[model samples]
Target: MCNFKLSSSPSSLLVSTTKNHFLISPQPSSSSSMDPQPHDDGLHRWPTPQEALEEIKAIGKISGPTAITGLLMYSRAMISMLFLGYLGELELAGGSLSIGFANITGYSVISGLAMGMEPICGQAYGSKQMRLLGLTLQRTVLLLLSTSVPISFIWLNMKRILLWFGQDQEIAAAAHTFILFSVPDLFFLSLLHPLRIYLRAQGITFPLALCSAGSLLLHVPLNFLLVGYFRLGISGVAMAMVWTNLNLCLLLCLFIYFSGVYRDSWVGPTSDCLGGWSSLLALAIPSCISVCLEWWWYELMIMLCGVLVNPRATIASMGILIQTTSLVYVFPSALSSGVSTRVGNELGAGRPARARKSMIVSLFCAAGLGVAAMLFATAMRHRWGRFFTGDEEILRLTAVALPIAGACELGNCPQTTGCGVLRGSARPRIGANINLGSFYLVGMPVAVVLGFGLQMGFAGLWLGLLAAQASCTVFMLRALTTTDWTLQAERAKQLTAATNNQSSPPYPPFDKQSKAAAAAKVASETFCSGDTARDGCSIEMEPFIIIVKN
Candidate 1:
């Protein structure tokens, strides 16, 4: 007679017997047939059709709210710019420059960090490692906070940076003042980012939407009171930003507390799990550089526009184009979030096939939307530029730029969606590198030569940008299409198992009896490096051999 001992760890189950075949008896209500034992470890377990359908529904539910929130936030910011323009050209130019600086320094960094959280949280949630999910959230917060110090110092020196870019004295002074009032926002914004990401990871996006709407509602009236009525000018815009962020931070914190998501077990300092300050920096530094590189490229383009004839009008018109395009981008951006969560969750759950399917669906949806936006922008080209300005010359120039802008939307969908897919797979470096190559190596130089060297003006400049975006889209699509889901699934499974072992003790060590049971469990789970090699489970030893053995 053979005996079996059940182990405590969910990853490994032990059964002792002389027989070669193990029977996996289903529960009384389960309809599964009694046959060869299936995998007992969690990695190889697949979601039921019902579960997949639920996930898809959840993705759909959040998309609309996400889009609306993005639209509202951006619209409020645009309204601020419009109001500032009414004061004077100097005020308008200064406000635009300062806001650009603040966005690149504050919002861009927060958004990038928030992007990193999606994959980590989604994976942890899907793998059923709830404690690790909490740990990841804590670590991300610590990481963002620690980095805020250096970012603050950089903001303190904003005058010098703008001077280097050849901004006149008055412009530099306005930018410096705004930086002084706004630099501290980096920390506040950083705090808000993790909270937003926390809600997003749980598939609860409506709260963020509501909070954004609340901020928008408050920002406009406050802007009118400060800049228009009080004559605080640029300083008023700065104050509005500060108060709005504070409001958002407070609201989100309350939401987290009230939702009971931050109980004693989940919420606390991460000093212990952080492993040390170096670990946090290791994740954040690369991400910071990545975002800076992308934003700086656009900043460079804007600077180049300033060197052209009618610098003020050139910059202003381009600003309108940028903001308008950004508004349209809300759709693709929302879809990207959906893709990130879906792909990350599926990958974490060891369902690479499902992850692949989700990516395709997301890509198709994004492409269809992109086409629709292109048609809409083209049809409205004559009237579209009037929304930002009424100057006949500016409007005329913008009309010519519209078709190119509309065409640029075609590339937006694939590139943004591909970025989301890569982030979900915990491979942001790949997307970052692609952007660097496409924008800097290929796109910028073309725009410079055509716009300035050839004197093609704004038309030439946009053509250059369009080329870059198209190239990026092509490369990203190829990358997405070529992903090897089977390999990804194996890697994900190994990573999850290793994380599990580290967090808790293994049920049995590699003794004769334990090895036999471990081998059986691994086999049933299809735990092999290669997709083939049926019936024999092979545990990867490269990354976690020591940890697994220990």
Candidate 2:
């Protein structure tokens, strides 16, 4: 029989056995076990060095699809702009203004909602909790649907709002018509956001890129035929928008169903996965508010600018510049999505060091893309104006603004990528607050003061806006640079584990028979010397023997 001894010292205990080796770990007291244990709070918490490098590489690979999606989406937007320009100044203004409004209302809201899914789904995916992933998607879809009704109402009543802006009857009428055609598309658009988020969380991004590419192909021809040949004007543009959104939604749905992800045993709804409706609402509301506030600030700026100058040419020029800047924003926007998904996943997997490394890689990549875009914008600055209109005065004025436009790209890339990093961490409120303070509290007032009070016109207003964005970029970069990845990883792990229980075991420990069988075939053996004629006796043993003496 093995002999076991109790030691006076509580911390150290030893057991002596004749055969097998044994390990002893001191069990904590009941009170100690019940109490919280101190956790590692270092700068990074990747379990191993190899894991850190693997995460960075994985995140880097995932960004390709995101970048492609951004490019496709940008192409669609540009094509729409091109179509609007072909229709004449009044139609261009009307189309541009209406598109701007719908985008702020619909696209921005969808984008925000999509962000809500990243942290939740990314964590779930990282933890390998497939069921929780499906439930999160379902919950997001339900919440987004609920939010859509209020937005639809807002879209329907947009004309009344435009009337308050002092828009002429013609512009107001065109805006109303465009809105009517566009509002119904929100339902389809809502589905698209959640679907994109779901695929992205799984590190599957090519589907969105492919869908966007397909939609753009169909969108261009439809816009041309409806607006150019059919003379549908603003209505044609609205129709094209609807068709594109519908196509995107359908394609995404089909891909999700066919990918077999839905049918996979690891994925789908579970008892604990559904959670309370309130949990989803809690996340969604803040996310929505954050996005709405940011978009609304820009809309407010545009409306205020419209009323500040006479002949409305000033507003039109500003709209042109906004559209131009938005086109270049696609690169950073894609990079941001890539960062959020990758960072959230790594954090959820309890790899803080990897998350930090991925963030750095994303920022560097985004900055490189930003530099290339700036160069392109600068080189093509003079030629770009002719694409929008034949007006010499508009072209001349736009040319003057090119350098500043290029400068804005520098700030835009970092700010957007920063937002993505924050969103992946489920910290949209921070981004929202930063945008509000920077744009409204500082940027807007400065622009208004320069444009009207100082009588410096549109250039002054843009200059002030640029300064505000630059400030925002600085603040965001600082926040990203100084983020505590260890804390982020812990939070990510808790959230992911809560949502999906990926850490839970599917089977319990082995039974007694299995344990005995495992032990019997590998018996302990020893060689000993006792008494022999010429040499020590050779001993054969079934179990290995270990001798200890004190």
TM-scores, each model vs. reference: 0.79, 0.76
User: With candidate 1 superimposed using the best TM-score fit, by how many Å does residue 45's alpha carbon deviate from the native?
Assistant: 20
Regions more than 4 Å wrong, model 2: 1-57, 82-90, 224-233, 265-274, 307-311, 498-550
Q: Give the TM-score of candidate 1.
A: 0.79
Candidate 2, residue 475: the lDDT equals: 68
lDDT at 422, model 2: 77
In candidate 2, which residue pairs clash? 524-543, 524-544, 525-543, 525-544
- By lDDT, who's the top model here? 1
Tens digit of lDDT per residue, candidate 2, span 331-411?
Answer: 577667767876776666665655666677667666776687778778877898787667776776677667677776777
Model 2: C-alpha RMSD to truth?
A: 20.2
